[model samples]
Target: MKREVRIMNYFPGCDPTEIRMSGNYRYYLSKKGERPLIVIGMNPSLANRKRADLTVRKISKVAMLSGFDGWVMLNVHPIYSTNPKAVKPTVNNKKQLRKNLNFIREHLNKFPDAPVFVAWGKNDGVYILDTGRKMVNDLLKEMGRECYAFKLNKDNTPAHPSRLPYKIMIDAATNMNCIYKLQGS
Candidate 1:
């Protein structure tokens, strides 16, 4: 099933063509054209091309405040659904993941050195979420990209971009420290 791309007016100028849903959900990219930040989300929420999802909106705001020229978004899961249950079954979809990695790789190639923001929140202790997390981690390692975790709570997990307070997200931005890396080729 394909995600729908409506023709509604979206704030900050959302164009249907820009939302890449070839393999999965609508990937809302920033117009600044300088992807200085790489945002990794758990998956696509109800947000689509018609409107700027909360995650994209918040991340975009933080990117601007942090002085980043622009930001790009990817997800741990390839399923595009507003409901979490929809993506739960594909926790270990290696085939889909490989396809999605192409998107990630292309983005990394374009923005080779952009700092990574690992914002994939642990999905209620689901087994699939864990598998997805592992795949994302390994992919980053292979790409030789340094990943950072958001200081969302005591655990300092990658904070999920929802209706989180602007100050909270801003503070999490400061907590961006190297949490993942690759040593050898």
Candidate 2:
């Protein structure tokens, strides 16, 4: 399949890059700069190199306001889906999950000093994303890196950027603290 590529005008003259595999799974989306904010979400939506989804746009705003020149968006799951609840993984998806984790690890290593923002949110009380969140946290811990969020749900899950109130999100962007405390630590 021919790859589709386009430059996003989100940063205006700043080159943006995107990586997708087999035409559907997006591994990364980044607006290039010296200092990039790392954001980890639950999964990819319709956002692409050609367009910015609401979440991506919101992240860009928060990142810029928070003193970062650019942002990189990653997901626990790489499959593209607008409704995250609809992404039910099968046995075959386990391989994809491993690949996603490895990609996250490698990319994160490249930005050792960049702050990581977790915004996967509570999976609508279904708890479908608990395992993924734990896996991510484990990886971060093993790597000796920590992540923060604008807000965490009552249950302690990081609040999804798309669902957060603008004022709260903006205020917390530069003043975030670690929200997911490791168990028995």
Candidate 3:
């Protein structure tokens, strides 16, 4: 079988259920003609009612235009039971972090060459900077592939800030000699 290029989607702690409502997201995925592997965190931000809707649309569009493949949901979204007043979290705590690392390891084993892992949200950079080096190093020891991280922000829209990160990611991917583009925008 031919090796495939997969774009892994990582949304920290966002409700995955809301993704289906976004039309733009559907359109983008349809256009890409590839199924993407989606990895979402458990404790996503619950603020900003419109945030989830907007994200779904944006991500779907970008994936389709970029010709990305299928998605895999790594960490299962948490379901709060009786205690609704529990403190909502932002960054990945130790236990959650370990779960994420384990998930990455398993996926990398399955798709050794797929380079790009897309992380949505501002804090993703912090997570990657903190744990990515160690994770990548371990992966390299077993598999020769090198994985790179990218931070995608909501400011890429016309009304928002410039899409510098997008441009940077594209440039880096193009310049790299490797067959896989391990970057996030």
Candidate 4:
């Protein structure tokens, strides 16, 4: 299949080099400097637009209350699809996943101590996500960094920020010291 590559635009007024495009399947960042919160979603959703999407809004709000100066959004697969099961069909490919990992790795290297959020949400199939999760876990382990989750869902995965109540989200974010659960590597 022919791949459609896309670029991730950063929030307004931020530097444009936080991320860059490669291999037509990689995601780019827009924020210029250090971000306190770094989020990892499953993959690109068709719903994404020039403006922040629902998930982004939720994350931004949480970041603000967490006393974070800024945030960067990333994905596990870096593929765009509305179907929640989209990742299952393409988990093993190296082209996109490798590039995506490289992009994410650069940011993690840049922000050595920023909090990492795994917010892929519960999907019909998590095979791809699980793989991504393990990769993230291993990376964090290797770097001696930590990962976090909101732990509000039945499956024990991080709640998609959209499903979380604004008040509860803000409340949790403010208690950064106690809110997030450690994600095992």
Top candidate when judged by TM-score against the true structure: 2
Summarize candidate 3's per-residue lDDT along 1-185 as a digit string, tens digits. 43222223434432233222121111011111224433232222221223333333334334333444543332221221112123233354334444545555665566555453333223233443234334434544456555333333444311110123444433333343322233332
Rank by lDDT, highest first: 2, 1, 4, 3
- Where model 1 places Cα greater than 4 Å from the true spot, the runs are 1-17, 27-32, 90-94, 171-185
Cα deviation at 99, candidate 1, in Å, is 1.0
TM-score of each: 0.75, 0.83, 0.39, 0.74
lDDT of 3: 0.34
The TM-score obtained by model 2 is: 0.83
Q: How far out, in Å, is residue 106 in model 4?
A: 0.9
Candidate 2: misplaced stretches above 4 Å?
Answer: 1-15, 125-129, 182-185
Q: Cα lDDT of all candidates, in order?
A: 0.64, 0.73, 0.34, 0.62
Candidate 2: tens digits of C-alpha lDDT, residues 1-185: 43342324454533356555546677778887678888999887867776777777778777777788878888877778776666665664556777788889987888888888888877764233455556777888888776788788888878889888767777776776555554331
Total backbone collisions for each predicted model: 0, 0, 15, 1
In model 3, which regions exceed 4 Å deviation? 1-59, 72-92, 118-133, 149-185
Q: Evaluate residue 56 in candidate 4 and report its C-alpha lDDT on the 0 to 100 scale.
A: 64
Model 1: per-residue Cα lDDT over 93-127, one tens digit each: 65666666778778878888787878876577655
